[model samples]
Target chain A: MVRGMAFDTSRRQVVKGFACLGIGATLPLCCGGTWIQAVAAESFTLTEIVDGVHVFTGANELMNEANHGAICNLGIVIGDDAVAVIDSGGSIVEAGAFLAAIRGITDKPIRYLVNTHMHPDHIFGNAVFRDAGATLIGHRNLPRALAARGEFYLRSYRNQIGATLMKGVEIIAPTMLITDRQELDLGGRKIELRAWKPAHTDNDLTVFDPATQTLFAGDLVFLEHLPTLDGSLLGWLGQMDELAAIKAAHVVPGHGTAPASWPQALQPQRHYFEALARDLRKAIEDGTPLAEAVGTAASSARSDWQLFDEYNERNATAAYAELEWE
Target chain B: MKAVRQDRRPMAGTASKMAAALALAACICAMPSLAYSQAANAPSEKIWNELKTDVFEDRTIQSDTGLIRIEAPKRAQDAALVPVDIFIDPAKFPGGIKSLTLIVDVNPSPVAATFQFGENSGVTHLSTRLRVDDYSYLRAIAETANGELHMAQTYVKASGGCSAPAVKNQDEANRTMGQMKLRQFAEQDSQTGKGRELQLMIRHPNNSGLQKDPLTQYFIPPHFIHKLSVSQDDRPILSMEGGISISEDPNFRFDYTPDGNGEIRVEAVDTDGKVFRDQWPLEAAGL
Candidate 1:
């Protein structure tokens, strides 16, 4: 499901109203003056963590009009020769702001545009960079996954976010596929990209920057937001275990705030998915029907995450059916 | 007709006006189900009367809810392929089941399919997948040989059954349309006390006439399995007339008697008038 709002509806309403004021007050300022700088500053905010590495933190939230469709965490890695962008935001507007933010920091050409996965929140900004001559990069399964569900995702978003918000939302397939692992030299720094098994999704990839020691672990690590399951739960747990051993100083998650210890950032999600798998297996063993399993499985994790009501039951149903066959 | 508005109010005119009309009809078909919405958990007499009058044509129905058991996901993962299973025990019924009708209360063609079983059909068990078009109740009705219709229902949350895009290769789908394969499972039926459960799989695109071909950007004309029949030695035992709601690579399961030492024949005909027939013996097909 395409989520369009961040956490807490009351706060979102307030934020939406303030955003309206900010845009409205600047209408007159847009008459070819210092509006470009003012509009850029007010439209989106980016935090420069260290040199050549910047991140835009979308409210740990949903995808909607007020948020400018930036509901996921995206990052940029700049090297001496070129820059590699890790996941653009939900729409072209967000992508344009992201490109502007990159241009403000550096004049280097963007060489690599890596999508963590095919979720609309993370990968809908491909055309903006494609036209800018950035080669789209993704996991091996990304192109197929995009082809299979891309139109459905677009149609659903058009129905939900309105056509105006999705004026340039094109399902751009990745030209380069990272089969196992690929490394790119951004000037002196080298960024490592790995295509994963069917974990978070069939097309999940992680971008690891050794210079910064920051693992851009896309949807693989959800900090506070609930872990939405779209792929194999068993595979996801396996990936969590494998990723825990790799030492990284700090991590940038796809959706939430990541901490220094990247492995610790993954515990709650690992627990949630493990809980789902265990409960589903138990239900399957007991011959408890799908509806009943959906009603009861993983209820304990409901309070720990946002949008648990929307996604967990479906997660349980999918997990139950998969485990039932096995 | 209730009311035709200027530019057809709720939905936009993005799709072809004709396509939009069909889709609107699909949405409007969901209204009667909403009347049963608030009291959804309880089976209403009015709902049954409407179904009988419209689909069953004033046929008297008996309330034997527990006699029929339907299995389906409460919220389907894919709107186009919602798997369902219906089971009816002869011991529970006064007489054996003769006909079964599967209905999605919100689909454009709400009567998704109807299956008429012969006396040789053994136990009344059927399993298949359907396109659910919208969030509405799915009814699996079993009519006993004595002409008593019993119903089992589950509320499914899904949509786009009649119009979901076909993501498979169209050329490949066309090349392999109407191919049918039968797999027999070793499960005994209570009614015949001598047969096993049989499953038949048909490969067809079942284009809804609503989906656009990705390459051409033109609406793919509706081509689906218009008729499917199963027989023992050419004696028709069970048959189904499907529409756009039937999924591609459609799968179905039923009960059959294997005591006749005769071959089980399957015939599937597509909307394009192409007919495919396959048969298998109690043991194997090649032998």
Candidate 2:
């Protein structure tokens, strides 16, 4: 008990520093200046994807505090009158850097903050935007998903990345929900938001910009990174087919480089899903149990994707459960 | 952090080698200590005999292989909710099954559940989820109508599931705690007959009195479903006496023959003496 003083002290600091800069859960005068500087000094770089559409592509690394919780793709879309930020980074410091990045580019007031899904890396930085008075937007099922999974994700991530980096990691839920499809005008520019059937997650919302012919296809479209199946494998396979018909020129996926063509960028992920389905069918046909099916299903596609070893087995387990009845 | 890591690497490498050498010395010195621990850890054969006698008092135990088969994952991905399938061949048991009992030997409360088949019921198969706290031997004892008892046992490897974080926050879990949902698996409610599979999802934190609440840092109270009973219309189907080994939001899928498309009802009592009930329509739920 006495030996864990450092960890316990840090945990206390983390709980104390939970809310965003000077806003929610304000700290006392003692460590105020140092804490604010520590938060403000965290740096992040962004790439201008297109005219008025800037994106901060995350490092192709796992969750770690050194990256200041910027481990997912985040972007800002500047409309005529207001600015809309998409997918805030993973922590409070990242959220501060995100706000700074927006300030560096433009002084437009942020009106909307859109979250792609319920993943913590994409949603934990919501407090910064909320403090900026941006109305939060997410899929209809996002609230329930947050309710069902929010606390667990928070605690587990704190354990994984340590509490200091997770200080500002609070669940800032969506105020507005996208059911099927809705069109939002960020002034003159129109971005179409579509919430699909339980594909990437039970609540997966994608943002499409008609001006640049660009689709911010959240985790629905994966590039070099492996596709993760947290929702239905059958549903994801079907959703891919629906996404293919939507013609767009540029696709800014949730991870990796922006795809040159819209739905065509989904080819690798489509192949991964197809491989998973085909092998799972054979496993089910042969009465292969879940343990064996995990190893054999989609084993051939291991070399083609990143983090395949980390997720393939789990994906196979889900696929086996679904395909056994089929 | 980087400086600390860099400074420690060489020391760690040397420490491991020195530790290996010291381990050889320590093993010789700690022989008696190790033997004493082994004796303390191993449960006596008398305790095993006593537990069996306590659970199956005065009942004759016969070894009849292949009559009942228990299927569970060798390595559970989620220890909190490990799916266990029990299949008893009705053809092998011409006497018909009278009751079925599930037990996870290592759990604080070993008797996970008990199912009593209604009259004219030919239930040879059933499945349910369990929260296994540690690596343990699980048993499924089936009692035939003729008073013969047969048991099937398997060892499962799993850990940390009982204390893993609950799916939702404390407030949400408390508010939704006693809510239940029922659905038919293989057979739809409209065309239910014999050999139809049905699933029952019960909403309960099923706190094992082990996991600490994040905010309070105290063990959530040991309030869990202690007993559950299911009936179709007026006729009884099955009953269970659950334990801490039952997962949060305890769920079950089993074969039950429907008696003319009747509404299925379920009644459960928790450890705190709170009774919860829910029912499915004559038609399937959410139909």
- Tell me the lDDT of model 1 at A315: 69
Per-residue lDDT tens digits for candidate 1, residues A137-236, read: 9988777656545655666566545566676777887889998999988877888999888767767899987766778899888877777666667778
lDDT of 2 by residue, B186-232 (tens): 45445434376666767676765533333344333455666788898
lDDT of 2 at A206: 90
Q: For every model in order, what is the iRMS?
A: 8.5, 8.6
* Candidate 1 residue-wise lDDT at B63: 52
Tell me, what's the RMSD of every candidate? 11.9, 17.5
lDDT of 1 by residue, B175-198 (tens): 656655666666544565634766
Please write out the lDDT profile of model 2 over residues A1-326, one tens digit for every residue: 01221112122211111223442333221121334333433346666656667777776556676776666787777788888888987877777767766777788899999999988778878877887889999998787667544644665566556678777567767989999999888887878999988777778899987776668888888877777766667778887878887767777788777534666788998899999999988875553445566777888898998877656765675556545434
lDDT of 1: 0.66
Best by TM-score: 1
lDDT accuracy of residue A149 in candidate 2: 49
